[model samples]
Target: MKNDEGEESRVLLENYRVLLKKALDYLWERIKVERREVKKGKRVITKVKVTLSKKEEVYKSLRDELEEVNVLASHYVDKAISDAYSVLRSWRRRAEKGKASLRKPKLKRVYVRVKSTLRKVEGESVRITVRPYEYITFSWSHTWFSPRVKGLELGEPVIKEDKVHLPFRHRLPWFTPLDYLAIDSNLYTLDAYDGEKFVTFSLRELYSLKFGMELKRGRIKSFASKHGRKGGKLMEKYSHRERNRVRDYVHKFVNKLLEMYPVTTFAIKKLNKQEMFQDADDKLSKRISRTVWRSIHRVLKYKAPLYGSLVKEVNPHLTSKSCPRCGRVSRKAGLSGVRGVGSPWTGN
Candidate 1:
């Protein structure tokens, strides 16, 4: 939230950004890299292991090095260090997978990670401590979502440039699934089998939205080459619309599917987009990219718990080539080998 003076907000955001970057740089300097060889089947592969300095060790060093960080509280320094380590950990994972370059990461966002200890609840107001005596309060009494989260627990708040985001957590009990549903994802449809029969969910609307936006973007690019800012804004507008529409379509599809088959274990093929792109032609790669294969699986996973359902990703290798009727692997074994419709349990 903005303070009385405009410059105060800017200063506050800048201060946090600077402190986070400083902490990130400090942790980045202490990164450790090691090489090791492992044998798989008949081949030996070299792997790289990347790590950062221990949190306790870094905390000790930061407390002594960052003297100016005490303007807010001692805990803020610890939070910054923790956030920095999180960034490094993510980068390390991507680097190991050969998805990211082995280079230092830069923290570009302006925000402060407020811990639970620094927050106090007073009726409808939440007061967050900046210093020992100074605090900031936000009211949620009149907010639209306040009633919806009546019994939920408030989590740690994060401070952004113009607002403070308060998170709420709801606990749900784990459930036992009744049956299994196998899914086959394609460019414009998702085919599912529930042991007895098959069901196909059409994704033609999503495909059309993406395809139409691509054409619009192409036109925008040509216009942008002539008129800079106007065309750029048009391109950005369409981009945002495309993302929102795609997300909306995916949510609706998942919601409908979960409604029909609640408390069921859904089996899906685990797809590797990077490997797929490397093996596919440019046209096929573009189509796969438009399909956004991971979005459906990811949404299904997160929303599964809400519907008392579970999603399992099995290996995609030779799934379509295996016979569904009988336990056999052949080029023309399955009913629709081209579609790669295999049994989830046996990968048929």
Candidate 2:
């Protein structure tokens, strides 16, 4: 009886996720495109219109079909009656009126992303597609490709099948006692403080590959200076490699911290970010799991529940500031120039 109930609940949650995902994709897709444009020149609100058939079955995979439309948007834009600026204005007006349709409405587009299995129809324009459902697909095709494409390949967009299960964890109750500690992550080190002990490790150990790439890039740049290679391409390749090193640095740090300092509560610095661009949609985005702190949190969530560690976020606002002596505020904590500098022994 419980197994059946669990299955039903999972299905319901997945369906709910699918519905919300569609609505989010509508607004989010445009934002991603605009961000790329902002990186190129300026930031602008680009709205694209979409039209959805009122008939449900008529659009077997409605959301998937919309994605298809997004991929082929460049093709549409090329053939659009309005230019990029003009179409954006038109889209804004209609969106303000809350009349954006999902049934192939004209949308002013300024940016686009390369999703999974995306293939560009090479001719006068480039096109891409996403196979969302088993038999359904979403696509994008365009001529005005944004230059701010960092790490992306035009292929089929990866569609994550939603799954909501009890977060797998390994933690003991408060009643159970153990002698272990783990520090959280910060800008300096991966895990700075958990609650009891400070976890410290070298960042260089995990990202040896990155260090090697950096050395290779330096050689390439040197070669370029001697008219043998292009430094720009070499730098680009090296930067990505180094960034991957940082990601692995965090992951290894988190795992080691957890193992060394076993505790029920893992305290970490809560980062304040307006928007985090995670690479979950594209093939490369999959590697984003390593860069973001989300990876550590995920591990703690799953592994801690079975053990005794529990992940917790510290109030990053007053961490470096707020003198513990008189409760004054300082950015450098009186190290540089500020008032009410508390001592290191003040329960920091």
Per-candidate TM-score against the hidden true structure: 0.75, 0.35
Per-residue lDDT tens digits for candidate 1, residues 2-63, read 33333444555576566678887787778888889999668887788997788877687776
Give the lDDT of residue 164 in candidate 1.
70
Q: Roughly what TM-score does model 1 have, to 2 decimal places?
A: 0.75
Residues 1-348 of candidate 2 have per-residue lDDT tens digits of 012234433433344334334433443344311111113235454444433223333333444544443433222222221132344445555554446543223322222223323334343223333223212222222313333332333332222233211111222467433443333333223534334444454433543454466577778777767764466666677778776766666666567666666655655556533222231255433222223455556656666644566665656655555443455666563344221111221214
Lowest lDDT sum, 10 consecutive residues, model 1, at 337-346
Could you tell me the TM-score of candidate 2?
0.35
Between which residue pairs do clashes occur in model 1?
Answer: 320-340, 342-348
Model 2 global lDDT (CA atoms, 0 to 1): 0.41
Please identify model 2 stretches exceeding 4 Å from their true place: 1-199, 206-250, 272-302, 322-348
